[model samples]
Target: MGIVLFALLLVAVVLLEVNDSFLNPQFYSDTLRDADIYNFALNDLPRSALDEARLIAPQYIDPSLDENPLVSAGLTTGDFVAALNRALPPEWVQDMVEQVLDEPGDYITGERDDFSTRIQAGDRVVLVVEEIKTLTRQADAYNLLFEQVIFPNIEDALETELPFGIDVTAERVAEAVRRVVPPEWVQANVEAALNAVTPYVVGETDTFEVEVQLSERVDVALEEIKSILLESDAYDLVYDEVVEPIIKDALGPTVALPFNITISRVEITDALREVAPAQWVQEQAELIVDATGQYVTQETDSLNIDIDLRDNKIAARDVLVRLAREQFDRVANDLPACSNSQLGSLVTSGLTSLPECMPSGGTAIEDQVRGVVSDTINSLQRQIEDAVDTALLAQIPDTLTFTDQTLKDQLAASGASDNADLLDDVRRIIGEGWTYTDQDLRADLLDFDSQDSVDLLDDVRSFLSDGWVFTEQDLREQIGDADPDVLAKLDDGRRIFKQARTWRFLVYFPVLILVVIIAFLGGRAWWGRVAWAAAYLTISAAAIWITFGPVYSALSGGGIDRARQEAIDSIEPNHDFANTQALIIDKAIDTGAFIIDGFAAGVATNAIIVFVIGMLILSAAIVWPRLSEYLYK
Candidate 1:
């Protein structure tokens, strides 16, 4: 009877193992894949790696959406403060102020047309300002401006503008000349100098040339001057020197001119006729000048001097500007580099323009460029996220179907039994983790980790790293359905998490059978055998609690509640995320969560049923103790 009872326990345990794992539909490869679906959703894939095999799903599901993927991925600004302080750059007003009043420079030498002579090197390239002479002699506004606004404004304009090696001191020379010599004497001397500097009389196509040496003092001083003039600011000085003089010269005490300065066209045309080469050219020059003056005066409506002084030699506007450029270039050309900078005081004592041009920041380009940074950053964030999603999800269906097919092939090859489902169950448990023994096989609770919050798939895959195929093949050979042998030079591999309780249901059944055999041989009564069997059951219940509860907890680590929370809570949705992206993410989370919960509950339920059975046995053990003395009597 005891042996018969032991046989019943063996049957019960086998049934429990089959119901919990070997026969459960969720353990099938296709069903277990749903758990993979859920986790891929909640976690971001950018930092993760992709699973290659699960790229494709079976054709029975939607080709695009149904693939269960294991993402085995390793993976300001201030507004204008009170508007005006920041409205424009701080140097703008100064720039405009400096523009009207310029600086002066020392004239040097290059080449210029000098009809009066055959020019050569080392000769002064005298600028014959015929138009300036005409304008000044006639009291023209152009002449007045040349003496004040234009003259002073450009005192150092060319020198400052040209960054070439030419170092000039035209401003200093102009000041020196003004201080030491009368204007009439210089003019008379300049006329005399022009004739003396050249060997021929003035003609139609003569050019002038001069050569000059650069002094060490000039070069060293000019370097300092250039730096200084870059930021020299004397708008007040400009007004006082250039504008004030103009005002005083024009008005003499009142705003209006002291004399009637009538610089009319008749006066200009008559002057050009006096110098005209012939009568026809003179007539043509007058006609051209008249038309130009009328057009210019009409368009501008200021400085109304509708006078034509067209000459065969040159037009006043064209000739004067060219002459000025030539003069500036002359200072630049033929300038030998300075000897040395040892003459520091000698060089720098003469630099001027202290109140005009200031050296400073020119203009800030980034003020216009910084606005686009904000948009670019946001776009980049979205792009990186999207790219990761694309790469990770790119071949999901392929990976899934590939995995499924590979698993199916391995299962078919095992040749364990004709029941495809049973073979699949064997494959899954063996796949989940390495089975240590037949004892491990029968112990459903031994297949999981002892810790919580571990990724079930990764942990199993890592431990069962030989993969389901090789490990299953080895384990299957060991645990064949008939006459299994657990021990014999087995390689206990690198990692092992848990072991089956040695005194589990299978061992207890056999031990019970041995006791029953001993009782029968010793002639113990049937009632005594029954009482001992019941008493053993009472002791085993405690073993069940000790042995089973924690095993169940370990197996149930992949609980549905935990998985569901990982999914649902992760869906604390991104309101602005695109609708389609959000939908797929949320769905995957749910599917994964549900699958895990199902797995955990299935494991826990198995544990509970076994525990309850133990309790029932305990009650029987209590009853048998009460009956023991009665049976013996």
Candidate 2:
């Protein structure tokens, strides 16, 4: 009994803590918060309807329903009671009594006759008592029927219908629509209507009422606004600026597109192919940019762009105007063959409609090509940095810092005096030179054995401070001669390294304290604690693994890659290489990590609930006998 009571108390405390502290502002931000982080989660984003329901659900219990206006106006508890009393008059009460006492013969009189002598002085009192009991029973029946049948139905109907009267006005609807639409769309539309009536407008003040009546009409009005802006010619310039780039990215290579590709086709050498298959594509793009850039630079050389603007170079806009003119000159003078009939017209048209955001009087084509070149180069640079980082990490010692002194000590202890020169050669190659052989690396390690202990407390401290994980002993064992199995376990354990220690306090530590209390409070009775703790940890860990691993991996590049492949396959159904969407396919492969993380996290949380239930049953099965034995002993 004591154990059961304690368990119940502990459960109550945990529930209280979760509800009053953890859930309100944090975990239960919305039904959808956790779900948004990953899929398969309960959509907890509180809608207006859900909030209203929560407020109203508790009020259902009150018979008076005083707080609710509609309920107060209708048949509440007081009103119902009053109505019942009025319906039952003196004659109605007496009739109820006669019905309860009805008989073919005079049975009431017979009983009365038998008790006549005893009740002679109180005959009037006996008749009053019979009448009271009969009326009481009838009132009770009427009250039960009214409450259970009629009142609940009425209350439910009111609850279902009341919130509809909370009107969403026209102003509110317009405000919501304005906020929901993307900013770029709004800006583009506004620019298009430069000379026309304002693109945005509010109709009647009762926007919500209008939505209820003619919502489709509002949509048509919005479309008409957009169409009017398009007719004004102001939108033509802004639309072209935004749509051209979007089309280029989304549609891939197309002859129908306005832009012409004059790639300086180059022969692919064996050396170039070995280094980069995309080299031809990159070189061609760069050549096109350089040709245009040189032409503009020469043509604009004599033209003085404001020296103040050049010298100060305060804003991007200041540099852009000058650069555009330079690019225009470079394209016309340096690349004679690059000029097209459309180049002059496009530049003139583009500049004539330049917004404050657009650059003026320069080679727009060259500027765009330059941006493309810069993007491609930047991407290549990042790839190089990533590759170098991977290589550098593989090379570094996790525990011991390398130096001449350490190297000399290692060499002396190895007892390879004949190969002292060989040691020097290996060190010189790996430590000082750009390249190293496998033999050289292995020979250097021959001197390092299991017995050597290197202190790495500083490294561990740094890792901890930086929200990473490394321990002195763990580092030593990994870098030194730890057993392969031990190292593997340590490696597997390192998964927790990236977790924010601060978050652990908020999410896991409270549950941990409860686990400890449950396990140890009853003198080494660990069954319940072990089972529940293991279950919780398993679920949490699984959630982390799925969120950060396989699901994340699947969602990352995998989904994108699949989409790309589908796109590519459509392009050329039979030709394997030609059928894939090259750009999207590349991106999918590159960005797999992020997508997989979100998917995995959601799956893991759902799995935890199922696992916890199983653990509870197992806890009961294992602990019951042990508990009984402990009590008996």
Candidate 3:
């Protein structure tokens, strides 16, 4: 009977341990609530999901499009994943998990009908789109696009398409000059000249006294012309017909020349200067000033007239004659001698030889000078503008101030209208983020029993259906035509799991009664009974220590790690989905190991408590005989 009872007692101990460790709802609740498990699912699971989504994203992009649409919108794969992670935050997953586990018993009994209703998966999609929009709206986001794509392309276009080393043409030079110094300003100065020269041209002052200075070349030419006239065969005719008349005109028609007497060249030059064409001189002076002003600043628009009144032997008499004749025709029109054609020709020819009477060449000289000056100025301007553009472009890659509107405007100006239009489309997509409601999602995604809707939401629903969103109905459909016996066994396990909550105490009470009965049957005296109880407690404690301490540690120490590695190794290599699955398996194993370690520690603690209590009782039993004898004395 004692042996039978001891066996029965051992059986009860085993049942009690099984009930507390496995069947108790509190055990499962505590394990599920373990911080390591909660955090692992919260952080690791979503990370794996995001990693898988990233690998799958490229496959989903439309093949016809030349590039990824998100890339066009300035979103990198990493950026999109970050935004998605933000949208479906870890806390959101934690809340959902907590809701599902709120009543572990309901789950144990398979009675929880609200698991699918805890958090709508479509809400996560909407959140993801909205989060992407928020990211795109940031000023820094535009900088990324500008730096990585738009600005570099624009720089290349400028280098290739723009005329950096512009051809220096006359027309282009004139345009550059006009841009810096407007034609209107030149015309205004010309009008001022007209005012200054009007008095002289209309002959308001014929006897006007003026000091004249001449350039060295002009002075030599004038002296030579005077000598040629003095030695010419027509010298007497010129004196009688042109020189004396010009002197008479200057001296109020009263001045007379002593002809038959030799007239000095100095007197002739002096007489001619009195009747010089002030109007023509003023006009020539204005042209020179205008040309010079284009390149150099002029202090005053004034003319200095110079003529040499000296004797010099004529070297080129014919050339001097020709120059004098041209000037004579221009200034001697109103002179009496100029009425005689032959004599007028001689006097004009003589006057033309003077430097003061040289032709101004209209605008030919001015245009040439203007062209050279303009070309220089334009080249410099082009270089400066290019440098500034390059500097601004370089800064764009790092600075956040380069906004979307600015980028759009630049792209449009650079003839990238297509890219500009794409930017607008991206902005529109971001601005109109996540417009669908729950009803929309239900009609589009959840109500798949009816005709399938073909839209963005529907596509999203299809993608998520692969792994994320599923219902109990889905599971039932997947379990279609399974063995009836297996189904019955599953049902039976669930029923037992539910009943074990209350029935756990029945097992506990029976184990307690068995322990007491075993102690009573194994001993007679009170000390013996105490010793027997101590023995049972010590044995049970030793069994627990051996099973949960060294033995359990040895079995589980590297087993979880090995299982985790094996699970990971089982996945196909070089595949994103498989890699993500491996991560899930790896973290799940870690969480399970953490919970198991906690359970083992709790069991060891309980064993240690039982052993201490048993030793204390044994000590009391050993001292009881001596104490009782002392009491009897």
On TM-score, the candidate that comes out on top is 3
Per-candidate Cα lDDT values, in order, are 0.34, 0.34, 0.47
How far is each candidate from the true structure, as Cα RMSD in Å? 44.9, 43.9, 28.9
Q: Model 3's lDDT to the true fold?
A: 0.47
Candidate 1: tens digits of C-alpha lDDT, residues 1-633: 444544454444544454434233224433434344322322332112122223424232334322232211111001111122222222332332222221100000001111121112111112233322332333333333334444454464433422112234556534433433334443454444344433221222223322221221233333343333222322221222222233333324321111111222222223323344454443432332333223322322222221222232243323323333343334333333322342233234422211111112223422222223223333443433343234211211211111222223333443312433454443333234222332332243434543332344234433333222223334336556443444222222101101222123453455456556644554466655544554544344334444444664566555644764564555445432334344455555556545555554544455455456655654665577678768998
Kindly give the stretch of ten consecutive residues in candidate 3 with the minimal lDDT sum.
Answer: 392-401
Best prediction by lDDT: 3
Model 3: residues >4 Å from true position, as ranges? 1-89, 104-130, 138-499, 508-522
Candidate 2 off by > 4 Å: 1-196, 199-600
Query: What count of clashes does model 2 give?
Result: 41
Error of 3 at 259 (Å): 91
Error (Å) of candidate 3 at residue 486 is 12
Predicted candidate 3 versus true structure: per-residue lDDT over 1-633, tens digit per residue? 344434544454455556565655456656666655555554556566555654554436543334443444554555655665577665676666654554444544544532342344545654654574466553244434444454444445544321111113333333333343333443344344443333332333222222211121232333332333233323232223233333333434221221111223444333433333445333433332233222112122222222221221122223333333334344333223212343334334432121222221246643443344335434444433343234221222221122234334445655666666775443333333213234543565547655444355445444443324545554444555576565566567767765764464464365457557767888898888888877777677767767778898898978887888888888888675786687778767876787778667666666666678878987888788889999999
Scored against the true structure, residue 290 in model 1 reaches a CA lDDT of 38
* TM per candidate: 0.19, 0.15, 0.40
